[model samples]
Target: MNKPSSCVRRALSLRPCAFAVLSLAAACAAHAEQPMQPLLLAQNARMPSLQDMVVTATRTEQPLSDLVADISIVDRETIEHSGATGVADLLARLPGVEITRNGGIGNATSMYLRGAETRFTAVYIDGVRVDSQSTGGAQWEQIPLAQIERIEVLRGPAAAVYGSDAIGGVIQLFTRKGEGAAAPYVGVGLGSQGTRKLEAGISGAIGADKALDYSLGLAHARSDGFDTKTSGAHNPDRDGYRSTSGNARLGYQINARHKLDATLLASRMNSGYDAFTYKPASPVDDRNLHRLHTAGLTWAAQWTEAYSTRVSVTDSASCYETTPSLYRTETSLRGYVWQNEYRLGAHRFSAALERREDRLDNPALTASGLAINQGRSQDALALGYGYSAGGHTVQVNLRHDDDSEFGGKGTGSVAYGYAIAPAWRVTASLGTAFRAPTLYQRFSEYGLPTLRPESGRNAELGLRYAEGRSTFSAVVYRNRVSNLIVFSAPGGCPSTFGCYASTARAQYEGLTLAASQQWAGVQWHGSIDIQNPRDLDTGKQLRRRAKHHATFGADTQVAGWTLGAEVQASGRRFENETNTQVLGGYTLVNLYASTRLARDYTLLARIDNLGDKAYELARTYATPGRTFYVGLKWAPQ
Candidate 1:
C-alpha cells in the first residue's frame, strides 16, 4: 500500500521516454499547413451553423473540426446570457476556469483547472461521472441550471481519454434534448441577505425526428445570516437553503450508425451553516442534507468508414447528512464506460475503459458502519495524430492509465499550430498529468494511509487575433505539482503513523486575456486573469489562490431596452492552510435591465453587491453585503 510514491515512480519512468519523443515529433511535423484565417472563418462562422454532425470525440463520433484537444463550446446563447445561477455559475465565466466558494450562494463549490487539483477536475453529466467517488469533490449544490443544453470544456489531460478523474480537465454537461414548443417558463428573484428566488421550466417532445426530449425544472433560494460570532455575536439568522432539481433525456436514432441514449437526474438540498468544529466550545449549527441520484445509458456505434464505438452505463447516488451526528455521509456508485475509435487516414485513435464501484457509509469512521467499500477500475488508452501541410498544425498525444486503486499511469502531449498571416495565430502545448488516491485519501480512518498520487507538468502558450468587429485572445500557463497531499501538524506523525504528509510542492502560473466587440448594435466583453499560486516546497502562499481575476461586461440595445453592466474582481486571498488567513481584495458591481413588456413579457432588474463590500470568503465565511433584485419573465407564444 505504500509503494506508489516517489512521484508515482517518476511518472512511471517517463512513460517510455515520453512515447519516443512524441513519435519523433509526430513524424517530423507531417508537412505542416497553417493558412486558414478570416478569424478562422469568423470562428467558424459563429458556429450553430448546424449541419456537420458527429461528435463525442475519443469515444468515437468525430469531425468537430477533427479534434486535437483544447475544446470549448458553450451555447444556448452562452447559457442565457450568463447571468448564471448554477453549473457553478457557468463555470466561473470560463477562460482557464477557477471557482471556489464556501460562503454565500449555496455553499461548498470547487473547480480549478490549469492550476489543477480540486481532485483534478473531471465532471460529466450526460456522460455520467459527476465527481465525488468518495470526496474527489464536485457536489456543486447538486447541479441544476434548469437542464443545461450544452457545455463542453476539454482543455488537457483526459486521463488518456477520460478515466480516473481525468487528471485536470473535462467538463461536459449536455441535457435538454429537443422539444420545440411545449413551453412554460417562469422566474422570480429578490436580492440581498434576505434574498429570495424562484424558477420554473417545462418542455416536451416524444417521437418523430424529435426522438424524445423532455425537461422539467424547479429552483428555490434563500439567505439570511451574514455571520459574526466568537462573541461578536450575530449568528443565528444564518442563511437558509432549499433546492430541488430534476432532468430526463431520451434519444434514439437507430439508423445512420446507430444511436441510443437515456438519462435521469435528481437533486435535493437543504442547508444551514457552521460545521467543522474542533471544540471552540463546540456549538455549530449549519444543518445540511443533500441527496443526488443519476441514471444513464448510452450507445453509439458506427462500425464502418473508420470504425467507432461507445458504450456507457452509470448509476450514482449520494447522501450527506449533518445535524451533529459527526457529519454523516453515504455514497453509492456504479459505472462502466467503454470507448473506442479507429481511423487511419490522417491517423487518429482512442480507447477507454472505466469501471467504478463505490460504497461508503460513515459514522465518523474508525471503521464503523462500512467505513469504505471501494471498487475502482480504470483502463485508458489514447492516441491522437493530426497533420496539416504547409501552413502548420501538428498534434500528437499518447496516453495510458491502469488503476485498480493506483497502479500504472502514463501521459504525453504535444501540440503546435502556426498561421502567422491573415489575422495571426499561434498555439503551443506540452502536457503530463496524474492524480489518484482519494477514497478519503486512501481509506481514511481519520486520514493518513501513506497517501500519494498527485503529479503534474504543463506548459502552454496561445495567441489569436482577428479583424473586423474585433476579437482577441491571449493565454499563458504553467503548472508544476509533485506529490501534493497536505495536512500534517499532528507533530508530522509517523511513530507508526497517525498522520503526516505535507511536504507540498506547487507552482501555478497564469495569464489569460480576452476581448470581444461588435459595433453599431453594441456588445462588448472583456476578461482578465492573472494568477501566481505559490509554494515551491514552502515558499508559502497558496491557499484559496486568487491574485487578480477580472471580468467586465456590457450590452446594449436601447430602443426596446436591454442594457447591462458587470464588473467582478478578486485579488486578495488566503483563508488558512497556514497562510494565516488574509482575504482582502474585492470588487463587485452589477447592474442589469431588460424590457419588452409585451410580445410575451420580459422585465428584469438586478443591482447586486453594488459596493457594499465587507468581504470574507472564509474566515468564518462572511460575504453577502449589498444586494438587490427585481424580476419578471414569461414566455407565452
Candidate 2:
C-alpha cells in the first residue's frame, strides 16, 4: 500500500530533524565498542553472538546458528519496542506474515503465512499445541504479549515433529521464567480513539535455590469506535476488555540424566467488537468473550549419552460467547505426546506417538453448529543426518506420519548450507508437507460434509552474508498444493443454491529479503516480501493474499537514550474468494523513545499511526488512527 498524501507530508516534515539526530548518533557510535545501547536485557542478548542456545527447530537443544532452517526469534525487547498490544500485532511484523484484524482492538484476528490458509500455521506454548482441534486455527487476540518470554518462528513445514496443522510453519512461545530476583511492575497508558490501558505483573522464584518460577499478569483496555453507522449515530462503539493470566513452572532434578518440569497456565478475557454482518439497527456491543486454560507436564531423561526420551501431556480448553446466539461455542482438547531421540555423531533419529481427543459442543446450533467428538491418534518416525566438514553442512530428513482421520502421509526433506567464505553462507531446502481437514471442515453436517484434507509441498533457497556489523539474508520459495480446499457452488445439490466445499489445485511463489546493519551507534533493519499466489487451474490470485509487503525501521542509542522508528506497508489484496472486491494497501508508521531513569527503573513513550490515515483492514472494519502512549517500568532487586 502507498502512504497517504497527509502521511507523506508529515513524514517529510520530520525527515530533516531525524537525519540530523541519526548523523550525530552515528558519529558517537564510531568511538564506542557497542553501537546500540542496552534498552532491555532481552534485546541486548538477541544478537547472534550473545545467545547461548535454542531448541525450537529440531526438538533438541542446539546452538542457534547451527540449525539448517530459516527461523526468526522475537525476544521481549522486540515485543516491547514494537508498540504492539497483542500477539497478532507482534507476529504481523515478521517476514512472510499477514494479519487481518476486524477492528481497532480486542477483536477477532486471523493470520496467514507464505500464502497458506489461516489454519495451516501451527501454534504452541511451551511445546504444547494450542490451536483448537475443531477450528484448526488460533485466535490471536486471546493471547496477550505481556505473558510471553520469547517467541520462535520456524518458517517452514514442521509436521515431522509437530504432527498436524504444521503445513505452513510453526510458532512456539515460551512463558516467562524467574530471573535473578523478584520484581513487580505496573503500567498505565492512554492513546487515540479514547483508548486507555492498565497492566501490572510480578515474577519471581519460590524456593531457596530458585528452582520454582512463577509469573502473573493482568491487563485491562477500553476503546471507543471511530465509525458512525447509517442511522447517523455512532455504533455501540465501545470496546472494553480485561484479561488475567498466570504461569508457573517447577523443575525438579531427579538425577544428572533425568529432569522433570511441570507448567500451569490460565487466561480469561472479556472483549467486545462489532460483527461483520449487516444489521438493521446501529450495532454496538456485538462482541465475544473468550476464556482459556492450559496445563502440562514434561519429563526428560538421558539413558545414555546417545539416547534420550521426552514425555509430555497437556490439556487446553476455550469457550467463546457472543451477544447473539449465533456466535457461541465451547471447544476442548486433551492430548499426550511421547518422543525419543537417538544421536550418533552426525546422525539423529527420532520417533514419536501422540493421541488427541477433541470435543466441540455447540449449544446454539446456529446453521453450522452441531455436537461433534473426534479422536485423532498419530505416530511419527523420522531420521535426520547432518554433517559439517570443511565449512559445508548438509542435513537430510525423512519423516512419516499416520493419522487416524486422514490415514498415512509421508514426507522427506533435504537441507544444505555451505560457507562460501568466512563472511558468507548459502542454504537451500526442499520439503513436502500437508494440512489435514479440521473437524468442522469434514464433519459439520449442518451445512456440508463432503470435504477432503489439503496437501502441499514446498521448496526454499536462501543466502546469508555477515561481516562485522552488517548481516543480510534473502530467501526464495515456491509451494504447490494439490487437493486445495475451496468454497464453491455445489453441483447437483438437492437443496437451494449456496456455498459448498470443493478442491482446486494452486501454486504460490514468493521471495523475502531482509537486512540489518549496525554502524556508528545506529542499527537499521528492513525487509520486503513479494508473493504471487494463484490457483493453477483458474490463474487467479488467492483471496486475502497481499502481493507485496515491506517493513523498515531504525534503532539508535545516544548516551543513555534510545530512539526507534518503524514503518509497515501492506499491498492491496482481494476480499473474497471470487476476487470481486479488493482492499487498497496502506502504510503506517510508529515511533518510540525510551530512557533509563534510574538503576532499577525506565520510562518509555510510543506514538502509533503518526499520519492519522483512515484504513480498513477487513471488510467495513476500520483500524485505529494516530495514537500515543507513555509507560514506566520499575524493577527492584
Candidate 3:
C-alpha cells in the first residue's frame, strides 16, 4: 500500500544492472588468454616505485599499484614513530578515517571510515575476525597497538569479498613474523600523567633449513589519567587505566608445496570512567573491564605451478564488564574458509567457501528473565575474476550468503582501472552491500523480530598520479542505504519502550584528496576529506562526524636524528542527529624525534597537543592537554 517501499523499488531496479555487469565481465574474461599459471606477486612488477603488496583488497596478495580500489598500508616503523596511545588514535592520522573517545585512552571509542557508522567496518587480526555481536562492531578500545606489526585499510564497500559487516570497509592487522636470525628487543617508556610502559619481544627462524619461524611478544602499560567528565555532575577524581597483552606467531614450510601458520593474541584492560547518577552525594569511581582473545591456523598447498589452495580456521572471544553498574556481555566467533586460486597469463580466478558463527551472552539481560543467550551463523560462496594486461585492470566479484536467521542474500561488485598516461590512472567501481541485524537488536527488550537487514548501493570514481617519490590521488564516492535500522517510539514489539525499526534511509557521499611527496631532503604527506553523511528522511548530517577534516605532516633527518611534525584539523560538527548542538572546530600540532643513543640503544621522544589547546571529541567529554613521552630501546646489531 505504501507504493512498494523504497527498498523494494531499489531492489527491483538493481537486478538488470547487475546482470549486465556480470555479462560484460564474462565477455572480457572469455576473450583473454586461456592457458593457466599460478597467481604470484613477483610476476606483476609494473610500478617500480610502489612495490608494497596488500591482501585486504581481494583476500589475496596483490601489488598496491595494481589495485583498482582505494587502500592504505601502515607499517611498524610508522606505528612506533607516531607514539599513539591507542589503535584508534593511530588510525585517525590516515586518510578517510576519524575517531572519537569518551575521555582518554582505554575508554569507550568509535571510528568512522568515510563517515560510515562504527559498526559498518569489519576488523580482523591475522586471519581471525574480531567483533562484538552485542555491540554490533569491533571494540576498538580493547585492541592493543603494541602487538600489531602491520595494518591494511581498504576504504570502500567489500561485501562481495567479505560476506557481511563490510558495508563501510575492512581492516586487517598482521602481527610480527620471523624471517632472519634470532633477534630480541626490549623497550621502556615514561610519560606525563604517571604513564609507564614495558615491552619485550623475540623473533627468529630455526630448523636445519630455516623451515620453522616463530615470534613472541609481551607488553604492559599503565597510566594515572585526569578527570574525564567536566559537567561536575559525575566523578571528579582522576580516571586511570592498566593493560597487559601478549602475542605469538609460528610458521612452518614443508617442502616447497605445503606451508602452515598459526597466530594467537590475548589482552586484558581495566579502566576508569564517569558513570551517570542522580546528583550523587559523593563521587563514584567506576571501572570498565575488557578481555579479548584471537587465534587462527592456516594451511596452504600448491598442487601445481598453476593452482593453489588455502584453508583456515579462526576463533575469537571478546568480553566487556562494568563494575558497580553491574553489566557484562560476551561475544564469541568461529570461522572457516577454503579458497582456491588459478592464474593464466593476465587473467586470475578465485573461488571460496566460508562459514561464520556468532554467539552473544549478556548477564544483565538474562537477569530481566529474558532469553538473551543468542547466536546466528552464515555460510557463503564467493567467486572473483581479475584481468590485468597492458594498461587496463578489471576485477569482478560475486557472493551469496545464507544466513541462519535471514535466509539468503546476494552481493556483487565490478571495478575497472586504466592508465590514461604514464604515471597517471583512472578508476571506477560499482557495488552492493548489506548488514543483517545483530543478535541484541533482534532479541533485546527494545527489539522487534520483523527488523529488516540494511542494504547499500555504492559508486565511486578515482584519479591518481604517481611518479618517482611523489604520488597524488582524488576519489569521489556516493553510497545510498535503504532499510536503515534506527530506534524509535514503540512499534511492532511487545515493549512499551522504544524499539528498533527499519524505516530510516541514509546516504554517505564524499571526496577524498591525498598526496605524498619527497622534496628538499624531506618527506611530506597530507590528506583532506570533504564528506556529507546524512539521513534522507530528516535531511540532517550524521552526528559526531565533521564535514571537513585534514591532516598534514613532514619528516626529515637532521644530524643523525629523525625529526617529524604533524597537524590535525577538523571542522565543526553536530552532537545529535537534529543538528541543534554544535561541537566547535579544533586543531592540534605534534612533534617527534628519534636518534641512536649508543651502539645498541636508541632514544625516542614525542610531544602531542603542543599548544595544550582544550577540545571535546564528544559533548561534555574532556580531551587531553599537552602530553610528553620518551622511551629507550636496546637490540643487538
Candidate 4:
C-alpha cells in the first residue's frame, strides 16, 4: 500500500468518534482467524532475591527494593511484546506519569511526572543528558525506539545524585549492545494515519578473543498525519512528518581490569504544523526541520578487588531550522564526570564529581522575545553510602551544585528499608531537590532575570510484595514546591505582554498502585493513581493534570501466538491556571496481536483507540482515533 499525502480536516465530534470505533471493529473482524503470540516473559536469570541490581537510583548497582526511591524497569522482553511505536506510548502506562502531545506521530510532546512541571524531570540516553537546551526538556518525539534496549525510571526527588532537573524524577535509556554472538534483525511496518517505517540493525563481536564488540542500527519513518486541529480552522490540510535516525556503539576490553566504550546517536525530522488560529492569506500550515546528535566515551578500570573507577565525557547538540524570518535555534551541552567506588563486605561507598556547560544560539529567534547567545555552566560533587544486613537496608546521598548563573545550592536524601518476609518489604524516604532556571526562562522578554531556582521537599512511604509469579506495590507521597515561576497577567504586569515572576506555592499529594501477575499462560499488569495537585494560594487544581488516572491490561501467549488488550482513563482537568476552561475526562481502549509466521519471522498487528474515543489531553489537540497497523519482523533463531 502507498502512503497518504494529505487529509481533509473535519470537526472531530462524538459521532465521528463512534463511527471510527465501528471501522476498527470491521478491520479486526477481517483477521479473526489469526492467533496472536503471548506476552514476553523475563529474559534474564533471576537473582536469589527480588531486590535486584539497578543503576539509576544510585550511581552504583544495588537492589531496587533496597533503595529508598521508587523505580520501574522496562526490560527488553517487555519492549518486544508491547510493540510500541515510540517512547511516549510506552511511558504513559507507567504509574504516576502522564503524557500529553500536541498531535500524533512526531509532534511536540511533554511528560508530567507526579504532577510536577515538565522541566522538573530529566531524561538521559546511556548516561548522557540528551534533552534540548532551548526548551529545557527532551524532544521525546525525535527519540528513536529502534536503538533502545531498556528504560530505567526513578521516581521522586533525585537532585542529590543527578543535579538539576531531578526534582520530579529521572529517566535513563540504555542502548542495545552486542553480547555473545553476531546477530542481525530487520523490520517493516505500515499503519493508519499514513504511517510507514523501515528498520535494520546488526550487533556482534569482532577479532580474536571477542575483545571488540559493536552495534549499529538505522531507521526511517514517515506519516501523512491527520489534521492537528479540527474544531475550527481556516486551512484543512494534512500535517505530514518524516524522520531518520541512527545509533552506533563500540566497546573494547583491553584486559580483565580495563575497558573502553563509545556510542553515538543522531536523529533528524521534518514535520508540518499549523498556526493557533487558522488563516488562509497568512499561511497557517508550514513545515519545520529539526536535528539532534549525541556522543559519549568512557573508560573503566578495576584498581583492586574491592575498588573500581570510571571516567566519561559526553556531548550533545540540537538544532531547530525554520524560516529565517520565523525562527531558528541551536543548543549544545558538554559534560564530564569521574566516579570511584569501594566495597567493604556488605557496605558500599561512592563519590563523584561532574562538570557540564550549556550553550545556546538563537540568532534568528532573538526577535521572538528571547535573547541570543546564552550560556551557563555547573559543577557538582556527590557522595553516597549504602549498607545491607539481615533483612535491613539503609541508603543515603548528599550533593551540592554550584552554577555560574545561580550561585550554589545543596540537596540531600535518606531512606530506610525493612523486610518482614522474604517477599514483603517496607520503605520510607525524605528528600530535597531544586530546579535551576532555564536560559530562556531568564533571558526572554517575559523572563525574570533575577529568578531563583525552584525548590522541593518530599516525603514518601512505600510497600511491596513480590513472590514467585506476581508482584504488587503501593506508595504515598507528598511534595511541596516553593518559588514557582509563572507569568504575571497583564493586569499585574508593567506591560500588556506580562513578565514572568516567582509568585506561587504548589503542593502535590498522590497515591499510586501497581501490580503484575501471571497465572498459567495469562499475564496481567495494571496501575492506578490518585493525585491532588493544587496551587496553595488559590486552592485550585493545576493545569493539564488529572486528579485520577488508571490503566488495566492483560496479555497471554499460547502456542506461537500472543494477544493483548489495554484500557486507560483520566479524570477531567483544567486547561489554564484560572480553572475556567475545562477538558472533560476520557477513556481509551487498545488491542494488539503477534504471531510467528515461520522460522525467524513474525507478523504483528495493533489497533489503537479501539472505540475511536474522542478525547483530549490538552484542549484543541487532535489525538489519534481508531487506528490500525501491521508489520513483519525477521531475526535469527
Model 3 reaches what TM-score against the true structure? 0.91
Better candidate by TM-score, 3 or 4:
3
Give one digit per residue, the lDDT tens place, for model 1 in 155-210: 66655555455656777777776466577778776655566767777776666765
Q: Give the 10-residue window scoring lowest on summed lDDT in candidate 2.
A: 6-15
Cα error of candidate 2 at position 19, Å: 19
lDDT of 2: 0.67
- Candidate 1 residue 455 C-alpha distance from true site, Å: 13
Per-residue lDDT, model 3, residue 146, is 91
Q: Cα miss at 636, model 2 (Å)?
A: 2.1
Given candidate 1, what's the lDDT at residue 563?
A: 76
Which regions of candidate 4 deviate over 4 angstroms? 1-51, 282-284, 323-325, 365-370, 490-496
**What 10-residue stretch in candidate 3 is worst by lDDT?**
6-15
Q: Which runs of model 1 end up more than 4 angstroms from their true locations?
A: 1-91, 95-118, 122-134, 138-154, 158-166, 170-191, 195-222, 225-321, 328-408, 426-432, 441-463, 466-469, 472-515, 518-523, 526-637
Compared to the true structure, candidate 2 yields what TM-score?
0.87
Query: Looking at model 1, which ten-residue stretch has the lowest summed lDDT?
Result: 6-15
The clash numbers for all candidates, in the given order, read: 11, 1, 1, 9
Clashing pairs in 2: 236-284
Q: Which residue pairs show backbone clashes in model 3?
A: 37-343
Q: Where is the poorest 10-residue window by lDDT in model 4?
A: 7-16
Put down candidate 2 lDDT per residue, 446-524, tens digits, no spaces: 2345456677788899876554555556789988888876656645333344433656988878877665666566776
On lDDT, the stronger of 2 and 3 is 3
Which has the higher lDDT value, candidate number 1 or candidate number 2? Answer: 2
